[model samples]
Target: MWLEQMLAAAGRSGAFYEGKRRAGQYFLRYELPRTEAQFALLESLDRTTLDMPADCI
Candidate 1:
């Protein structure tokens, strides 16, 4: 699941131009591990939090 999210973000980064010339631009490449342990480790650093109102629950 975490890997999927990472790949999706990577895809949104756009394409890569090796020898093309540009004024001032850059491209980043994101690589995610394919192992469950790796995903767990990555997710542990950035866990999400949910907030609910007192009367909502």
Candidate 2:
């Protein structure tokens, strides 16, 4: 469910688009935060799985 929500947000943001192929693989590209504190928070959040997936936001 979280993955689905993330994908939807990404699609809305134009960060991901439907590819020519109809397979399971979807195309996605986006800019990530570039600060130490941000990276650390991301890492910690990822480890804990407390927040939604990266694309969810």
Candidate 3:
């Protein structure tokens, strides 16, 4: 969806297209993989949060 939008924007402006293209590539390369680790960490959460001692708050 975003790539399609970026490509559409390329038809409108070169600079805007390049910027979005580079940003999207960066996100896909560097940021996308973080979701796996983040989701795994999230999945590890069980009752620990809810069971925390009231005094800690």
lDDT of each: 0.41, 0.45, 0.77
For each candidate in turn, the TM-score is 0.20, 0.21, 0.67
Displacement of the residue 44 alpha carbon in candidate 1, Å: 0.2
Candidate 2 has a TM-score of 0.21
Return the clash pairs for model 3, or none. Answer: none
Candidate 2 lDDT by residue in tens digits, 1-57? 434555555534332433222122332222232455787877775654545598876
Lowest summed lDDT over 10 consecutive residues: which window, candidate 1? 18-27
**Which parts of model 3 have CA positions greater than 4 angstroms off?**
1-7, 10-13
Which ranking of candidates, highest lDDT first?
Answer: 3, 2, 1
lDDT of 2 at 42: 77
Count: clashes, candidate 2: 0
Clashes of each: 0, 0, 0
lDDT of 1 by residue, 1-57 (tens): 443344445534433322121211222223323456778878787543345565776
Off by over 4 Å in 2: 1-34, 46-57
Query: Candidate 1 — which pairs collide?
Result: none
Candidate 1: what lDDT? 0.41
Clashes of 3: 0
